[model samples]
Target: MMTIKNSPASQPMLSMTGFAATESRFTGGLLLIELRAVNHRYLELNVKIDDNLRQFEAQVRELLQSRLGRGKVECRINLKSDAAVANLTLNPEMVGQIAQTLAALQQHFPQAQPVNLVEVLKLPGVCQTESIDTEAMAQSLLNGLSQAIDELIAARQREGEKLKQVLLDRLQGVREQISIVKPLLPALISQYQDKLTTKLREAMQAEDDRVRQEIVLYAQRIDVDEELARLNAHIVEMDRILTAGGTMGKKLDFLMQEMNREANTLGSKSVAIETTQVSMQLKVLIEQMREQIQNIE
Candidate 1:
């Protein structure tokens, strides 16, 4: 009846990468279990164990998949038997055959040294050790795994908290850039209209209604109000997701893509040096958040 500890009211985020290990000693052997995880598009599990513990593979995979949502997880089990449990026992038939062969060799070469007990035992198939209790070993390994998962989750949570703060800071920077760009829009449009009118008058040597229509069309092309509004909305959504925690890597990644799209549009439509600078800064912040979000879970 093992259960994961409940998350606190202020839920912290979780990173996909972490490490944990646990060990248990039984009457016959020592069992060591280690878990390592890193970011992946989906849950990918790999387990390694000594032949004696191979029977527990399904159970271990089930336990890991139930606990983790997304990551490339690697599980390793090392079993070391005690001296008493590993003590070799003679295979009577194999030992008898080896003894007969050694006697034949001694008769052929009288000067050869007599075969010792150690030499006979060293011969393949002459000695063996008893098998371990697979059922008992599986139980012990699972118990150790339960504790290891708990520690791994804790480590991920700690790293996630730091990632959350970094994203939030970048989000705030995006907001600041949006604000800066918003004020410059009106002035940019006015300057473009004035410049267009002057150029048209100089080229045509007279006022023309067609010149005014062209200015309007050019102004509309550079208007970034829609992009700014969408950028602001994306920032709000990102903040909400971070606050609500748990398996947010994919969601955050999508949001970064949306934010980057808006930033790109803003840069392309820039009419002034200040607007271009703000767009560049916004892109830099979004890129930073995107990189960090890749490691979140």
Candidate 2:
């Protein structure tokens, strides 16, 4: 039996998509277990098993829930008699004896039915099938199921590593966009002040205290420094969460929402073409991360 265990600190981001299969043979039967998983907001398990294996469904469900955090998981278990295990062999001697007896009976009663091969096979000892060991079959089923789960988790982890790298790349893209927006802020303020001064001088023909106050207020309104700062903070937290990965799907998603909110605010306060483009690019990157996060567990 294979035991699947991982320390929380060592656990990586796990994708909810995976597949695995395992089988074990007993006295006269073969037990097969298969697992499939796909993304879901919560753990959703559906188990299907042979009628004889119904008794073990609860145990299988418990085992899956204990190891998996989130996914729509489907488990299928089947038990079937293996011909090799049954060891079906013809008893040549028995067949010869039965044939002789049937021939003799037919001669004595001419009207008697001709030798019926089916009836001969039905006679005692003419055909035999190995008896199944119920207990052994049960144990093999549980052990095979354990091994299958281990394989499924391994597949999920491999996929998760890929998702993690994608998310990290998108986060870097978001940082790049933010950096672009920061340098443009000072230039944007200067440009806005110049434009406002031109309009005021054209109407009043003089610069005054009123003009300075209006410029300050307009700069404050368009300042996205605070939103950018918060976005950077969210990115830092997201990096930390990814580094310490363990069921961080929901947390990463929430952080994405926060980042998007900041991006929206930045766009709303945009006073220049460069700032508007930065805001849109930031939102695109954050949306990409959020889409990938949905598949993480």
Candidate 3:
């Protein structure tokens, strides 16, 4: 009944996998459907049922296959019985022909043969008609399954929502780190220029203004401002998709890769210790999001 995201803080979350069990004792027997789902590259469903309900396999499969879009889902449907719904009728003509044949056999082998009444009954024509409300039973089972599937899909969506929220939070974390590293850029360049200028002046006895200007410009190019800008843009795009709320798994995953690319570039080009730390954090957060997005539909 509780079709909420199985996000237990003590546990590692319900995963992209979950189960919803529903039982509805309908018609003359009981109808039960168990729906289990796991993360899969595509939507796949396996259904299991007793031989009595085998005739309705297609109906059950279609119900689930249409409702669920992704994941390897397994559904087990049970149609059990407690009492017989109808009586069986015998084929009178077939039974009479079989009886005549047996009588002729008895005439040929009088002392050696005797037919058991149960054996005669088992000649296949003795028992004839089976009557049951199959339509009512099928409808009952389907109704129960429909309810269970509704709960199952709602569970998947609720979990997807939580995943979206977590990814967005990590994204915002990356943005905050980017913010922290932004104001440090100019100061970082100034620090590098001052150090390299002093080193150049002492190490090579180079006091030419042009040489110093070249060193300053070279150090500025190593700054990660451009990488930060691109990363921020990627973050904005990812946030847009998360808000739009559809099947954006692959898109989000690609964005994660792009974010990590920018973070890596940022780390490699980064000069300030603060920038490097922030860049590393961005990479970590993106990796986390990537792992989670694999489970999304």
TM-score of each: 0.86, 0.82, 0.77
The residue ranges of model 1 lying beyond 4 angstroms of the native Cα positions read 1-11, 84-88, 101-131, 205-212
Q: Give one digit per residue, the lDDT tens place, for model 1 in 217-282.
A: 877988898998898898888888888888889999999999999999999998789988998999
Q: Name the lDDT of candidate 3.
A: 0.78
Give the clash count for model 1: 0
Off by over 4 Å in 3: 1-16, 84-130
lDDT of each: 0.86, 0.88, 0.78
Q: Is candidate 2 or candidate 3 better by TM-score?
A: 2
Candidate ranking under lDDT, highest first, comes to 2, 1, 3
lDDT (Cα, 0-100) at 269 in candidate 1: 91
Q: 39-113 in candidate 3: lDDT tens per residue?
A: 977888888887788999999888887767678888998865646643556788888898899788888888965
Residues forming the 10-long window of minimal summed lDDT in candidate 1: 205-214
Error of 1 at 204 (Å): 2.6
> lDDT per residue, candidate 2, 50-88, as tens digits?
997898888889888998889999999988887777877
User: What CA RMSD would you report for each candidate?
Assistant: 4.9, 7.5, 7.6
* lDDT against true structure, model 1: 0.86
